[model samples]
Target: MREQPPYLRVADALQQRITSGEWSPGDRLPSRAQLAHEFDVGDNVVRRAQELLITQGALEGRTGSGTYVAEVRPRLTMVRARSREERGGSPFKGDMASLGKHGSWDSRTEAKVPAPADIAARLGIAEGDLCVCTRYEFLADGKPVQLTTSWEPYDLTAGTIVVLPEGGPLAGAGVVDRMASIGITVSRAIEAPEPCHVTDEEAALLGVARGALATTIRRTYFSDDGRAVETADIVIPVALGEIVYEVPINL
Candidate 1:
């Protein structure tokens, strides 16, 4: 039989300690050098072992602090009302309603931005296409909860009243309603969620430690003709909340 590699062997040993209750949740483990000596491996090997545990959700790393046994994931929730049938208003408002909390948002709009490759694909626009970019910081009960940057094709809204997103009369209205006002009826929205680590900028705004886990959502709003009208990247810290999707069963 083939033998396991050094890092895996070291990680296994640490896992044993955690499962045996010797290292309790929220308890910091030995320093990398100490673990290297304990396992008779190099410091790099111990570092890899800790990374493995972190990826498994068995451990967590704080940028300036040491790694610790993972605690129960936070219970914060942001509800996703995927369908119009499930939605009452904007996603922020919907989330507040689900949690029985008050919600507010601050937005800044930037115009004449050229759509990058990924965004162009989602918005079905050409590369370097002019667009309006708006960044939103949402707060629930005076605490920052979610950050999103929305992009709208300039060619689609160049001379329209809602082109600036949060500047028109219907400013702050959602993509669904905003598009509806502009002769385009948004038929549906799709969201794809993935796990990621907090970046320095996000960590500062979301008030979480850098390297902390977070949920990144890529959302697209579609029109009646099935063309994408708007696209956004929404990031929510794992420490602040979780997301619940209201998916229905169709036969």
Candidate 2:
């Protein structure tokens, strides 16, 4: 029987030690030479072992500092693609509530922003159409967990109290509710989830390392009459929280 590689054996041993609480999260690992001596392996073997653990996300190397155990953080749950007829409450807040954590968010809205071509297409509008765009940073226990940028045709909301999303009486009321307040019924929405990588700015906001795994959920809402009323892109960290959807199963 051939034996496993020495480095893999060392990594497995270290994994067990870490999981067994012999070393806690954020605890610096021993020097490569020290580990090699303890494991009765060469320096190269210990380096290979450490590199493997870093790639597996079980360990991290800090510049000018030694490698340490990675700290695991809780991920926020994302519930997308709900039927618009359903109440348009904040799903992020609901997720936080379910986890016994307080949820809040900050938003900035800009009016008369010309829609970019891609966004305009999603909203079924012409390119450069005037629109109201709002960016939201969702937080759980005051920590930013997700980000969203939503675009709505200004024509659908012009002269309405809800024209400025997050600025009117219905501020932060959510897409369906805001549209409903103006006699528009958003009946359904389409959401597509795509795998993504974290941007530097998103990484800073989400408090995750740059290049971390992420997921982008793109959603578009349509009025009962088939008019596209709103669209948004939501970004979530893959490592932090889970993205859960409540889809009905057909028997």
- Clash pairs, candidate 1, are none
Clash pairs of candidate 2?
A: 75-240, 75-241, 76-241
Model-by-model lDDT, in order? 0.82, 0.82
Residues 1-251, candidate 1: write the lDDT tens digits: 89999999999999999999999987998899899998889999998898788767687665456778876644567667655333634657766766878788888999999999999999998989998999998888756778899999888888889898888787777887777787998878889999999776776565556577889999998888999889999998877887888777889
Weakest 10 consecutive residues, lDDT, candidate 1? 82-91
Q: Give the TM-score of candidate 1.
A: 0.68
The candidate that achieves the highest TM-score relative to the unseen native structure: 2
Give the Å shift of residue 54 in candidate 2.
Answer: 14
Q: Report the C-alpha lDDT of model 2 over 86-165, residue by residue, as the tens digit.
A: 64665556667768999899888899999999999999889999999999888888667788999999988899999988
Cα shift from native, residue 112, model 1 (Å)? 1.0
